[model samples]
Target: MASSSSSTKTDPSAQGQAATQQRLTEAWVRLAKQLTSSKDYQDIASLVAKTDVLALKNEKLERELQDALTAETRNLNAIQEVKNENMAMEDACRQKESQVEAAQMKESQAQSQLQKAQEEVAVLKQELDSNASKITETVNSKLEKEVQIRRLTEEMEKMAESFRQTEADLKKTNQANMGQLKMAVDATTEELNTLKALATPLKPQADKRIPSLEAIEHDV
Candidate 1:
């Protein structure tokens, strides 16, 4: 009788448990139907679509950022190259300026030397002019002395010719005077001889009367 009473009680408990399980299954089905038909479900669907579009936009923005960084790096390198080229150009300019200064200095020295050479040439020209003037004066003086010597020589020749003529005339006059003196001496000697001959005859007669004349003159 105890075994019969336990079997009857277990069969009632199992039937009640089956009823509870059936109610839980019905509630889960209602909940699932409500969720599928709600506005929240539609909002979740639209949000998922918006998230896909945002992901695509984010990928494009990341690619643009990477390209900008690459361009900036190239610009920085170009700026450095320009700076180096400017420094080299400045060095070349300084060297050119130094070369120009040296050329100017050499030109100044050449001008100074040319000026000195011109001054020396002027001095030499003045000396040459003075020498030419002295030579001209000496030539004129020599010519004047030659003219004077010629005049004196002509006068001496004229004086010598006049003296020769005067000597010839004097010699002729002396010869004529000697001839006349010889003729007069000869005439006087002949007259002296005639007078001596006449005086000899008279001397005898005068001697004979000399004594009588002397007696008569003595008586008187």
Candidate 2:
């Protein structure tokens, strides 16, 4: 019985040992499966990190594109400004040309007026010359008439002086000849009266003309 009981106890202990070994093998398999799952999780995390890096690069490229667009817009605005300045300059040049043309027209008009004035002056000068010649001719004719009148008046005064001298000589001779003095005095009186009447007609000529040489000598 003791042998049988000891063999029974040994067999039960061996069965228990076998059962523990089987349990150990199951736990090891479960641990290996967990390890594989951890490997998969790590792979997924790495893939996510790569995706994030790609996204960051894409954002940086977009920023660069925006900056390029802004720079192009600024350059376009600058070009437009330059175009506006050029157009303004062209307009100013056209205006200056118009002003210069107007000034030239004014100068031409002034020159035309000056030429007309010169022609008018020439015509006036010719008219003045004709008038001056007429005036000179009239003055010369008047002077010649005055000179002729003066010469005639001088001859008349000389004739009156000769008659007076003849009368004086006859009076002196009559005084010297007392015997024939009556007849001589009668004839001399008649001649003296005739000479006086002849000299009396020069009153109008005396008022209208200059004195003769005889008249001046008599007055002196």
Candidate 3:
């Protein structure tokens, strides 16, 4: 009976030690799992926030580059337009210079023609003055010749009237003395015949000296 009572006491002590070791190991495992899960969640949150900030910075840089390219295209077009306008202006200036030269040539030709016309007019005036002077001299010579001709005509008329009176008186005296002086009357007849012969020649000489009124009018 003593041996059976000792074995029962030892079994009770071994059972109590094994139960305390199992409880301590389960508590340690629960603490280690909670610590590892919290560390993984913190790392994921930090990486997502950094990616959003980088995307916003990239979009701003792209907009600025497009604005600069559009401005450069507009400036190139404006420079080309200015160059075309300058070329047109140069062509117009050359055309104007050519027109001015043609006008000056026409003016010079007109001036030369005017000077020639003036010289011709001066020559004509001199010829007209010379003709007028000659006409005046001819008129003075004609007047002097007319005065001399009139004086000669009046002298010849007076001489003819005196000869007619003398012939009438001689004829009356011959008729009264014819009976008493027959010989003398015959002698007087012969002398009268001779005088008639002389008078006939004198008539032709008088006709040659006188000019007709018609001939003088025609010469004037």
Candidate 4:
């Protein structure tokens, strides 16, 4: 009886092993059939290759996008720098225009000053000419007066010399007349003395005959 029981237990174990092996064998058979179809195998290989190619293209597109973004940033910075330079040029231009205007105003003022100076110089020249003419006229008048005085002095000297000559001629004629009158008076005195001497002699003679002569004369 113990031997028969051992045989029955052995039979159950063997049956279980047989079932597990049969299921494994069926799964293997189905896998082998699926692999053996050529169309299915080719379709799987083409699909795998297409997936790899898509992955490579996606990576390249990402790199190009990054480069484009970098270029756009650089362009923006360059545009900002140009705008700053233009603003500086505008400020410089405005400053130059203001300086030019100031210089022009100064030039105009200088021209005006020059014109005023010229007018002053002309006035001074005219005044100087007038003064010179007046001085010349005064000098001429003085010279004429001096000439007239010299002529009058010469005339006075001539008149004085003529008067002296006439006085000398009158004095000589008076001296000659006085000498003639003295000679005539001496002659007259001598004649009177002779007559007196003769009359005295005659008177003595006549005295004797006086009486007779007197008588005769009385009768005559």
Q: Write the residue-wise lDDT of candidate 2 on 67-138 in tens digits.
A: 988988998999999999989999999999999999999999999999999999999999999989987886
Decreasing lDDT order of the candidates: 2, 1, 4, 3
Please identify which of the two predictions, 2 or 4, would achieve the higher lDDT against the true structure.
2
Which residue pairs clash within candidate 1?
Answer: none
lDDT per residue for candidate 4 within 7-105, as digits (tens), equals 767567778899889988887888767765667766876777777787777777777777777887788778878888888888888888888888889
lDDT of each: 0.60, 0.66, 0.54, 0.57
Q: What's the TM-score of every candidate structure?
A: 0.42, 0.46, 0.37, 0.41
TM-score of 1: 0.42
lDDT of 3 by residue, 1-220 (tens): 9888987675766777777777677666666566446766456656666666666766776676677677777777777777777777777777877777787788778888887777777777777778777766655544443443334445433433332333344456564643333343334434444544444433322222322223322433
Which has the better TM-score: candidate 2, or candidate 4?
A: 2
Candidate 1 lDDT tens digits, 47-142:
877887888887877788778878888888898888889888889888888988988898999899999999998998898899889878766655
Extract clashing residue pairs from model 3.
Answer: none
Q: By summed lDDT, which 10 consecutive residues of candidate 2 come out lowest?
A: 202-211
In the order shown, the candidates' Cα RMSDs to the true structure are 33.2, 15.1, 20.4, 34.1
Candidate 4, clashing residue pairs?
none
Candidate achieving the largest lDDT: 2
lDDT at position 203, candidate 1: 37
